[model samples]
Target: MDDSTLVASSKSGIEDRLSITAEFYTLNNVHANSAKYVLLFSSDPSSVIFFGLSPPPLINNNTLTLTSLALTTSFRFLGVWFSLSASSQFVLKQARSMVKDMAALLTLKKLLAQHVAYLYNAVLLSRLEFRLQTSLFFDSIVQSIIFPMFSIIKRKAGLASTTPLALLYLKIPFSIQHAFCRFLLGKKFLLILIFGNLPIMLFLIFKNLWVLRVVLLPST
Candidate 1:
């Protein structure tokens, strides 16, 4: 696919692409390098995307090499920052005064995602030769995709002093936004919404409470 097609596809949902990319990284050494190169390309927006071609600094060593895995994880980290930068722009469109705090939180998330991605990639690289099934496959996908997405959402919400609970608002797209807002005006709005989305709402509430605690206890 072309560059625009690839970027548009990324919006489709990174879950499937992450799984497929993980599989490729498992099978071919080239894919590992390609993943790193993709991170590099993401870093430099002006860099030309050489579709269907080998990326810079070819992977000449064994796929299981620690050096290879380290580079891959490092770039995966840079990828997280790249995602945060883009998401920050979106948040700014909504809330400009929060930019400084948003940048700080985004930096924190970038570091956290890096650590998590490094650990996950290390595990995958070590188990490259082992037989992987659907369960483990999905587990890996969740590790790679969901965790990073959560980190981004958490950081974005932090910008507004909103906490991760704000991610609940994000789960619903703009199309349903007005409806949710109208519903929230009802007397039992939180009660109804909580009951309707108990599991997620609870999780979000926990995150929100955590933010409140942090705000209330500054020295803690």
Candidate 2:
């Protein structure tokens, strides 16, 4: 078959699979409400390609179409922001706003060091660390914004701006926190592979061997 025909057939197959899944859920009485929100996101870095086309409409077994699907530049899923270009800029922006608001409150209240730490853990830190596993692109930009806010709070609380003091009060730096989260996720994946079926176990072993070979052997 021609490329265009193959593409069309693949699209049809995907739509059919979605329809069958929706029907299964409907039979199970899932999402009995008529209102449904669907979003289409393209991972393409180019804006032109990302926004060029709309996703296919999803229809239920009763022929009810989900018309609520809209083209959005970004959307929140499971507390993590996902953008069309796969950039973490939106997440960083949101984190900045949240930290600023919390900082303003801390300054206005003239909160004690202990109180400020509690507030930071409850509000600002929670937001910063929320779904950290999903937003690994939060790099130096996020650290620059967050660490300064910590300094401001520390100064207000009459604490030194030293790294040790910051670490003592904040428990761990954001970079370290990110690394810990990644390590935990890696461990979880390893455990899954260890207990997984034969095919998955084989794939994991092969993947690790390939990675080790790539790291140990120089490219010729």
Candidate 3:
């Protein structure tokens, strides 16, 4: 079955809720029998879910419980990393490594300036597009990753590091990095969600934001 996450407000009823959920999904022929779940506490560790075995029906849970569930400080949900520690260095390090690896291909001698630019813009840079939508990238983080891609483009185009950055986008074949891709994409998504008028978005918008018509303006 596809991945799913269950959220509980407090320690109370966590066991019963999990058992009820597991049994319900298991009876429905979903892969809910595996007692595999990680706890990430945002505030007090004791304030969240209960620390105990799932149930006998969940086979894998028997060995997992010792009056407590496994607690982790960080875990990746889908492609984005979520952390209770509030440090993004791990995320940034991985992103930088990925960019560096992809940019290394730019050093190939066979690729023309346009070809280099095309590969960088189309393939390598597009990798970040999906991730940008999920996380808030600060300006420093943006620059840290963006500069490497630009540097590779500069090297491939026989330009020095000190060369005018504007020239790369204007004169050179390389396109400027869409550092605002995340914000632009988010705007587009919100526009669609707002104006598309799907039932769910409509319900949420009207329910929570009916009094706040200012959001209907250009770009709230």
User: Which candidate comes out best when scored by lDDT?
Assistant: 3
Ranking by lDDT: 3, 2, 1
Query: In angstroms, what RMSD does candidate 1 have relative to the true structure?
Result: 22.4
Lowest lDDT block of 10, candidate 3: 208-217
Off by over 4 Å in 3: 1-4, 12-14, 20-37, 46-72, 134-140, 180-220
- Stretches off by above 4 angstroms in model 2 are 1-38, 41-72, 137-139, 159-220
lDDT of 3 by residue, 1-220 (tens): 4455555444434444556555655566455323445444443432333345366564344222312222334456555674444456666666688788877756655766677667766776667665554455676667678677777767777888899767877643566656555446655765675567675854544331100000111221
How far in Å is the alpha carbon of 153 misplaced in model 1? 1.6
Q: Residue pairs in steric clash, candidate 3?
A: none
lDDT of 1 by residue, 1-220 (tens): 1111122122123323433444544454323333323322222333233223222233233222111111122211311221212232322222222323343445555454344334323432223212111012223332332243335534443444334434433433211121222323332544555468775855554331100000011121
Off by over 4 Å in 1: 1-136, 139-141, 159-170, 173-220
Clash pairs detected, candidate 2: none
Give the distance in Å from residue 114's predicted Cα in candidate 2 to where it truly belongs: 1.6
The deviation in Å at residue 94 for candidate 3 is: 2.2
| TM-score comparison, 2 vs 3, better candidate | 3
